[model samples]
Target: MKRAEVLVALGLLVVALVVLSQAIHLGPGWGEDGPRAGFFPFWLAVVLGVSSLWVLVQALRAPGGAGARPFFPVGGRRLVLTVFLPMAGAIALLEVVGFYIASLIYLVIYIRLTGRQGWPLTLAVGVLFPLITFFIFERWFLILLPKGLFGERLLPF
Candidate 1:
């Protein structure tokens, strides 16, 4: 388990480094406010890379690290899939369903899958969280999230 954890962290570190490199290639805007398209991405990639490396280091030093344990322990696979699969689905859903629907679906799925709670609670949170986020980001901040089938036409900001 520890070994796999370290490997995954290392992989994330590598990916972040790649993203950082790509971002750095895109020069930031010059003069006055110096933020370009890649400014945030590049910095975020740096932070992610550093953090991933730190975690990798800790895992390497820890007892029963990834190399010492089974690749998938009892309940490990379920835990990993439950967390990662939904996150991947959320990203994929962004293009197809857009942000609101995709986020709502993700919230609902997360509640249902992880919480093991009742339908009422799951539905309430799933519905409310996205609505609140929609209002906060779209209405308040004047920012737009991805739109899928249901988009600006139906729910214009």
Candidate 2:
């Protein structure tokens, strides 16, 4: 268990370091009156990297800490698959369906998968939530979300 925790912590730290480096390379560009686009992300990456390093140090130094448990256990295929499947699908959907549709689909899948809600309620909330957001952002606030395959069809209306 301690070994597993150490491994996970180190892995997370390495990933964070890589991300932090990338974020730093992508300079924050100054916006109208606020910080640059990459400013927040860059700082967030720095924080994540530092935190992960701290966790790695703790896990390594106290292999058998009294209150510690294994970060990952052996033969945890179900756990890996459970998280990876949805994330992969979301990445694919994000490209093909655009953010709005992808987000709606992701939310519906998540609510149903996690909450086990009824179909009718899930459908209602899923559809309405995105619609309302679209109305408020696109129509009222003049904020545009990505339009994927349905972009051209929406132009007339």
lDDT (CA) per prediction: 0.84, 0.74
Worst 10 residues of 1 by lDDT: 27-36
Q: Relative to the unseen true structure, what is the C-alpha lDDT of residue 154 in candidate 1, on a scale of 0 to 100?
A: 55
Model 1 whole-model lDDT (C-alpha atoms): 0.84
Clashing pairs in 2: 29-36
Model 1 segments beyond 4 Å from truth?
A: 1-67, 71-73, 153-157
How does candidate 2 fare on TM-score? 0.51
Candidate 1 lDDT by residue in tens digits, 22-100: 8878863452576887788888898999999999999988899345668777888889998898899898987787888
TM-score of each: 0.54, 0.51
lDDT for residue 80 in candidate 1, whole number 0-100: 93
Model 2, span 19-137: residue lDDT tens = 66776667665668977667777777778778877877876787486566545566576678777888788768866766667777987897799668998888888888878988899
